[model samples]
Target: MAQITVVQITCGQCGHKFVLNTSTWPSTIQCPYCQEEMSQDMIPRVKEAWGTASDLNMDFARYHADRNETKFSVDLIAEQVHFPHE
Candidate 1:
């Protein structure tokens, strides 16, 4: 509700667990599980993110032009159903 916290650290060799930072995202993070180093080259970097979704601004023109059509399927597919409310 207030802010988003994400883990940036992951195992470089095994691609295992992650240790994220609360306030910031690192460029190169070492994996805590495998002790392997991961960097900007290894993983993709994001300029701006709408939560877990990445590559938001990558296709701005195409998406913006077809925004209307994209909205229908996007909204339908994005729906979440929680009957018991977790």
Candidate 2:
């Protein structure tokens, strides 16, 4: 199984916090809450965490649709976490 990297990011426009699957990290993502489009580069990553394949409980292959460049996916969670801004 491929190792997955998990990251927490904050939406620059709406201050919405969410988690992301690095395997599916894309150039841009639509904000889940405000329905605003956000650039991956402009967002603030508040936390970095690790999880195993079993922890993810999802298939990474599904995200790789194009089979060319790497793919990224967004994993939103209900629990809230806070980290000092960098």
TM-score of each: 0.35, 0.34
Give candidate 1 misplaced runs (Cα > 4 Å).
1-12, 42-86
Q: lDDT of each model, Cα atoms only?
A: 0.44, 0.54
C-alpha positional error of residue 17 in candidate 1 after TM-score superposition, expressed in Å: 1.5
For model 2 the local lDDT of residue 25 reads 56
TM-score of 2: 0.34
Predicted candidate 1 versus true structure: per-residue lDDT over 1-86, tens digit per residue = 22233433334378565545634556666666766765566444432332333233334434656773352111102233788858
Clashes of each: 3, 4
Residue 16's lDDT in candidate 1? 64
Judged by lDDT against the true structure, how good is candidate 2? 0.54
